[model samples]
Target: MTAPVLEMRSIVKTFPGVRALSDVSLTVAPGEVHAICGENGAGKSTLMKVLSGVHPYGSYEGEILFEGSPCAFRDIRASEAQGIVIIHQELALIPYLSIAENIFLGNEHATRGFINWNDTLRHAASLLKRVGLDEHPQTRVADIGVGKQQLVEIAKALAKRVKLLILDEPTAALNDGDSAQLLRLIGELKEQGITSIIISHKLNEIAEVADSVTILRDGRTIETLDVKAGSTTEDRIIRGMVGRDLDHRFPERTPYEGDPGAHPALEVRDWTVHHPIDQQRKVVDGVSVQVRRGEIVGIAGLMGAGRTELAMSVFGRSYGRNISGTVLKDGREIGTRTVPEAVAHGIAYVTEDRKQYGLNLIDTIGRNITLSALSKVARRGVVDEHEETRVAESYRGSMNIKAPTVFEQVGRLSGGNQQKVVLSKWIFAGPDVLILDEPTRGIDVGAKYEIYTVIDRLAAEGKAVIFISSELPELLGMCDRVYTMAAGRLTGEIPRAEATQEVLMRHMTKNTR
Candidate 1:
């Protein structure tokens, strides 16, 4: 009925040797919650970048009509000036700064360039309240949980007087409770007449709150459906995303058939690790785990239940201090005191934070894939570029990484492809044991199935896998055996036949001496 709030007419964006977006069009109504769904590399992020001016005006060919006026934004600042703010999946808040300080970091409350702290905190308190966060304004951002940090990010957007807010994978890292809270907040924001365009792989969330759904597939807009019209279900969205019906969320995995009495590929005994900063707090306490050859073992726990801490600490003591652990390979104690030693001991860890810990974003895909095992391609003291190229190319083909070439920058790849690159790096290292933490966190259903296929292949090749995931269904689907962790202790170990959400939850929350 009313004129659309935003409209993009025939948008096209391209990178070297790659057409990221091709003649994409979008329309968003005023004060409506719109959802953008796509498989990785589907040009969803590129379209958003075009609108937010991250791609800028001259970099792409498009006509952007905002509130019935054709406008060209030269940069992100220009878009923000027109009350459009985009929040990335990776939050942009300074950890060490106070919440108030972070909210008003760039746009400060000041008189003649001198910041007025009293006014800043007073205003920040109101914004925090508006977002339903009860924390004090002076509380350090690092001290709070990730959900609160997300709220702080929104408060920062409000500081700029944002009218249109764009969130990319807003709940990718949040737990169930936090995700529910954030969704509720979105509903509240909608009631306040702030339009939101959410880009997420979580279809359930989209179905729950979206007024309209737009699906993209391989650099093109497939279709847009009105969610209130009762035909835009999650399955419908998936079909549009992948161009086919996905009957199952995960690939069918055959039961693992391996010698149970044989020594495990990797084992940890009585592992204990103190917090990196607080030595008195035991982040991982006397935990033991084992993974047999040709088997996928899972670790399940709540957000603060020490699943990630245990995995990181055991992987070359990478996470904690005052660590005491006994690591064994094939029934013999092996020294994994450092990262290099861990790799040498036939162990690899694909970190959960792929951007921060896994891949080198600025480097070429060829370089990133070969980085973990450079010695394999190195001749004498110098690296053989030819050998490196061959290895990277082989992995690029095997992993099905959607890039123009191996020379493409890894940062340019989509979330799923970037994950594939991270996996390729570790697989090239020839590890006997692989620790995958949240391997499919933000990827789509189709991409998730592909990753699951990769994991199955690794197990079939006789490599042990320690899979850690927040989703209980993932654990039940992929793991041959699942171990439950609670308060840094192992509570229960359930086989695939016996593992259920109810059983896992009981163990995940139980207290053990």
Candidate 2:
């Protein structure tokens, strides 16, 4: 009904080792919720950076026409001055600052550099109300969950008088209820004529709120579809994003149906773990789960369902305090109390948060790859650097770690490649059970397929793979059996044949009381 509010024509951007974007173009209607969908490293973020002045003018060859006027923003401030605000995947809030301070930090309303606390609080409070956040403006940013933090970020954007809001993976950390609330807030923003460009991997979320969709692969625009148009569907969008008919995003695996009953390789009895913060709170409430040898067992639940806590506690009691759990390896009471003891008893836990918990970013890839089970390369408390080098080099080739050399920094590598290092490190540890938490969280489709293949191989080798993921489809696809939890309690266990999204959702919400 109206001309496009923004247009990017023939956008081409390149980095040292990768062509981030090539011949990409997009048009966004006024008051439209436009979603940009692609796997990680597909250049969706690059396109947004180009538009938001993050990449800056002349860094890429492109012509951006906003409101029928060609403009080149030199920096983030320049773009923000024009009422364009971008919220990144990792929020940029100052942890020590209060909600009000964070919201009006740069855009502070002051008279001749004089303090204006009351005005700032009032402004921040109004913005918070607009974003449907009930928290007081004086609340500390650190004293909030990730979902509330997201709302605070939105409030910050609203304080900046944002016309075109850009959200990157906004709901990635949110629970189901919080995510639904955010979606509703976006819808309300649309009704108020606020244009939004959202970059996300969750296609269902995009489908719910997006008026139009754009797919990018390897920094190239494949297609942009109007939601009102007849041709828009999840399958169509998936095809455009991945360049293939993705009949199933989750690869089907045969659950443990071969033998009616089989001996579980890893078994736990009366596993009770106290909260690391609050000793009285039982984070893992007397739970028990067993994974058979050569079987993939999935843990599915909402955020804070104790799924991660359970895994961390069982895998060498790495997280919890006052942990009393009985772990039997092949029905043998070996007693895994410490991390080294767990590793010795054939248990490896590849952490969920890969960036923070898994790898040493500053260290070389070789070092991080051989961090666990160093005894293989260490003798008399001195590590054999040669053996470490050889092992790292072998994994680099076998795991297909894309880097010039094994000496390169793990942080310097791409997300997919860093994940390979994590997996390679664990697999080399020689564990009977591998606990992978959110294995493919920030990886691309191609990389995810590779990781799935690795998991498949582990299963084929008769190793118990305990997979924990927030995504139900991922659990249903990769696991022979799925165990759903709620409120730190085991709610239901579904075999592959009976596991459906609907059934899992019901079980996931089983512990409302």
Candidate 3:
């Protein structure tokens, strides 16, 4: 290839306890869509941060040459000045601001410190049209869905006159249609000679749009394949990323065939929870479920299936109003309806939205881990700080929560590490029944393996585990029995041996009003 548009040679970066990247090299040709594929903690984000000046010039040892000229960008603005823009996996958008305002936030069009509203609206509107976002510029960003917000982020990068755009897990939050649209836009950008890099875990997307693919494993570059050279295969890429073929993404499960109608460890009878809003309808319809000890029960459905609503409502009625549910444990009903009541009764919930509802971001990892079970380490309504620290430190080590110290803020950790904290918090609650929602959602492959082992161990310990996930493969692998839901109703229940994606998807899409 001729001189590439962007090149990074021998990039090396290390944290206190983690070597994030080592000898990573990449070259992106002008107008090409190069993909960086790796399991979680594969150093993809770290490398991109170095390239985009988030790490600055000296923090990491590397040589970044843009358009065949050596470059040093001290900050993100300096990199953008040279037409390189990066959209992080976690979006950086002002929720209350109008779409136009968010798009041109830092680089607003103004005169003498006075904003030019007309020009701003016209420019933002035109950019939105290019990205196929039909929403008005005046609309608040918070009002839009995740997919629309992603398109706006892209349009914002376009406003920066991006020459090389970096998107990190851009479609992680998007639905099927939005993901396709974003990929199409990249193709269109390529035609315009704007170089791009897309980082994603979804191998199908990589196969569709990537001109070249680089695989990073354990903070090292393993291989880079030329997709146009007829050597690219999804299997090959998976091997490079995880160092083995995941011939079977789902682990095999044995059927749990004890006596039917046996006493279940956790049971919800005729459960119902209404929306908190006045005149609101029931979010969770009359539903019922029974999970036996030492069983992993799976809930399968498409988005808004009310699976999560059902779980949260049952977990001490944390989600809704007018909640009427008879929660039975060991053949006896508990006359309790509070979060602590559930926890005290040996029922713990690990939420899907870990960031917002699970973790206290401002607190240290140690504190966050012990938050749920603070009373366990207290004496006469006073917490024993030493015991709390000891318990938190143990979970950090056992959960493999990577951090410089236990005192590190939970928010500063990566998505996977933060999730470990959430799991630790709930586990400390000493729950015999654990409600897990999307337990491995944003975590990396290596971390995912560890988490899988943890869940299996929990099942082995005879805990009634409710495993909820969007990925059907995980449900098939992990759950002892699978239950499918559609539009707030239980559609079907299939034994693990008989469960299949086709069967689950059929129930997942069962339309109900």
Per-residue lDDT of 274-346 in model 2, one digit per residue for the tens? Answer: 8888899988887889888889999999888899999888877788889886888877776777788888888
Worst 10 residues of 3 by lDDT: 250-259
Report how far residue 15 has shifted in candidate 3, in Å. Answer: 3.0
Indicate the worst ten consecutive residues by lDDT in candidate 1. Answer: 310-319
Write model 1 residue lDDT over 1-513, tens digit each, in one string: 899999999999988898989999999999999999999999988899999999999999879999888879999989998999999999999999999999998799999989999999999999999999999999999999999899999999999999999999999999989999999998999999999999999888998999999899988889999998988888899999999999988788888889978999999999999998889999788999999999999999988889899888878889999999799999999998898899899999999999999988999999999999899999887899999999999999999999988999999889999999999999999999999999999999888999999999999999999999998889999999999998898899999999899999999989765
Please give the CA lDDT of all the candidate structures: 0.93, 0.86, 0.87
Clashing pairs in 3: 40-444
Per-residue error (Å), model 1, residue 187: 0.5
Instruction: Write the residue-wise lDDT of candidate 3 on 268-343 in tens digits.
Output: 8888778778437777777788899889999987766788889988887888788886889979898558888888
TM-score ranking from best candidate downward: 1, 3, 2
Ranked by lDDT from best down, the candidates are 1, 3, 2
* C-alpha root-mean-square deviation, each candidate: 1.2, 2.7, 2.5
TM-score, cand. 2: 0.91
Instruction: Give each model's clash number.
Output: 0, 1, 1
Which residue pairs in candidate 1 collide? none
